[model samples]
Target: MCNDEDTIKELTVGRRVGFYKVRGQIGCGNFSKVNLAVHALTKDKVAIKIMDKMRLDLQTQWMLSREIFNMESLYHPNLLQLYEVLETPSRLYLVLEFAGGGDLHTRISSGGKLSDQESKIVFAQILSAVKYMHENNIIHRDMKAENVLYTTNSCIKVADFGFSKRVNNRNQALDTFCDVWAMGVLLFFIVTGTFPFHADTVAKLRQSVLEGAYVLPTWVSAPCQRLIRGNLRSDAHWTRCWVASGSHTTASPTLTPATPPSPPICVAWQME
Candidate 1:
């Protein structure tokens, strides 16, 4: 049934979005909604991000196209894979890999602090993905726990590129530092089950982040603390601040053979 607003109370469960059949709504955001869907021919489960074109400005539409193009061009095991795009007169649909394990935030919230091995695994995967992106000159401006998804194989996939941008050079100062800062925050959460900077209000949280005001728990191990603090340092040239000479060979012996070497590149300094 349609509501007074003339919108359906819920999108038809079996409605087709491109070659996928929508099973149900899985998530929603300010300008879009995501549906759990399955391939009509292959029966493969996927997540489809549906955005109503009528509600979007031309610039927003351009951004969406850019995101799709970026995702389509990039391929890494640790990055969420985008399969197809279906653009209609009224809407745009993006077929993406369905992460059955949800996001890292949900896992951290429900399972408590991650074991050291788990932390190492996740950190390794994300760093590998980010390093690849950097090598390709793509900066994932948005990197947070909510954007890191876990797969059925216990591997993490870096998701979301709405804020991503391509640059001519990664050196000479770049906004990718924000990504590094967020990675540091994710590392802190994995070890401590909480953010390094927290406040009741968004304004206060922004202030805390800008001022680099945060406390590290006494219980965290020295190596872990060093890793976190090294990335979360206060440096003007964040891209050049990674300790150990921006090496990725720091993987602990506990990490599995399948895991990528520890983040060898520079993580970055605090954000403004």
Candidate 2:
């Protein structure tokens, strides 16, 4: 029921979102909800993202359509596969690949700190997909852990590009930065097992993000040949600053919060 756990909650008066029989609600939020559904004809399982037209007018709807279009056009193991779209009078249905491992957040929450090598592999896989999207002129503005899904093969697939926009020209900078910002958040959550920049209040969260303050442990700095390690020259520069500030805003920032409390010293990754 993890995917279609919403068998009990009431939804907008209508039949199941699409051909997939409603197993139950997977998850829900302000903008949309996910349901576990099975195909009526093939009996194949899929996750359906149900969004109400009433919530979005022309602009957002167009953006969502673009996201769906982007997913539909791509064929990558690291990206969530989009099947088809089914529309009704009240809501729009997006048929998607059923990823069973769940989002990266669930894995990080239950798996604990990943190894440095593990982090490297995970980040490399993610970067590969992002690089592909970049070449395609698409920017996944929201790249946090919640938007990433793990396939049964232990592969991390980037999903949920609702906040993304395509940038065809080099001059397009607006809204592009949010994508990397979301990545930083994904990293923070992966290592810390917590939303490093999370806040209970909307206004408060906004204020904190603007502060550009976040913290990580100095010990997490493993000796490396890359750019990530060299940046942490002193205590105040990276780890200390973030722990004191509570938000990380740096691009390519070497932010890897305090070490795991204790667990045979797990390998830390670019978590989220």
Candidate 3:
């Protein structure tokens, strides 16, 4: 059990919490925090995400609930594994698989565009995960490079399902297809070495996404187009690198550490 009287600063870096013991800080947020934790007995590493009730509203609460629901309903290797959840009077806890490689956005920002084979391998795993989610009636509404993470084995682990939606038919434009659009955006970043959806502010970015006015810049390959257009439906297989949101080509540039956007609220989306 968590102690209500324990202030955030007083929380030790290695204190035991429930089945897992805190190892160190892995992530931090305004309302909550994530820690690199370990299974008490097994000593296995895990990522613990804590959501603060005090900082959340009813709508945010709903998003968190839906994300957990979607994760509970599906299983796939490429999808981030959610092992257990613990609730406290003041917070909600999620114990998830540890991906030490970190979010894909981090890798792309420092490494620039990945090679075609690397892109293919990564895309394949994402496709598999998306296909599995679709089969189980789930849609990943906010798919993006930052939301896409990787395991230590270099396999894909699509993270963050907060924005995912459920669809009964192919014709509807639910959050799931929006995730597909986000996926296309991510692929554009991976292949092109830049964010496909360029905007100076959040409101503008949202407008661009809703309008679907994404235009490809020069350097995007023809096959990239096929990838984006083919998989925006429930029946479609998640294959190929999509170029729907932006061009897959970017000017040759060196990479530095890049600052990424936060995950989309009510929509678990993020960009590198």
Candidate 4:
């Protein structure tokens, strides 16, 4: 648990942290909170993830280090950009690109289900990003709607690398199949605005997912239903082929690569 002083420091707003002036809290998780901040010099908006050092156990520390290393090594338009890393005696901060349009979960929850074209547009970006990660031997173990962010222009930005892993070889990374499964789940959520699997308990949920049982509404298009079914199949080999073929036929028009943004100035500061 964080002490009184540490808690105070975290809750305080408008204070400067490194090169950015912190603002109101935007989001929070179990051990860390994200704040919206602006760079003092360039005035660019950024999300600063503040983590309490005391709250991070050894396992969490290793995961944090892996997340940072994986993020720093990646350069993709659909992936979140990590601009800087800062460390202090009591806290650690990660300066990241800010996505003003909120996350996929919130969008779906607020606006109801997306139309066929809209779902294709969003899923295409996610497919491109996941394809890139697999090609680079990185597996995003967690690929839910919540981890998918949108920019002001509605472009997809996959974030949260805490569960990501870099394998030695792309072929050896069977976990990529799990990512394929997640893509199926995400696609279902995008079009239907609901999870494919539903259960009141964790065990039942696991069983539901494992059984791969879900019904598509009659309003869903035939091609879209086929794509979702292919992705959620038990055979990993067939699922991969289906994704490759279906992505082209379904979302080809909007599957064009996003232009990479200019690199940000990287800097680090230690607090006394």
- The 10-residue segment of model 2 with minimum total lDDT is 258-267
Give lDDT per model, in order: 0.74, 0.61, 0.66, 0.80
Which ranking of candidates, highest lDDT first? Answer: 4, 1, 3, 2
Error of 1 at 67 (Å): 0.9
How far out, in Å, is residue 123 in model 4?
0.4
Q: What is the Cα-based lDDT of residue 59 in candidate 1?
A: 84
Tens digit of lDDT per residue, candidate 2, span 1-272? Answer: 11333532233225554456777888886778988888779998898888887897788888888888788777765778899876655667788888777877777878885666656556545655665676566778778787777665346678887777777674453444454455556655555566645578999887776775456555454332222322222222343233223233432323232233311112233333
lDDT by residue (18-78, candidate 3, tens digit) is 7688777888876678989888799999999988788998888898888888888777767
Models 1 onward score TM values of 0.82, 0.66, 0.72, 0.85
Q: Candidate 1 lDDT, tens digit per residue, 1-272?
A: 12332233223333876567888898998889998998889999999998887999888878887898889889987899999876655667788998877899998899898886567667877877887787777889889999998775357789999888888755643666776777789899989999899899999998998888988889987767766776786663643444213442332323234523322221222211
TM-score of 1: 0.82
Candidate 4 lDDT, 1-272, residue by residue in tens: 33466644644434988678999999999999999999889999999999999999999999999999999988887899999987766788899999988999999999998876667667777777788888778889999999999874457789999999999965677778888999989999999999999999999999988898789998887777777887888898876665444343442323443334322111111111
Off by over 4 Å in 4: 1-14, 241-254, 257-272
Error of 2 at 138 (Å): 0.7
Q: What is the lDDT of candidate 2?
A: 0.61
By lDDT, is 2 or 3 better? 3
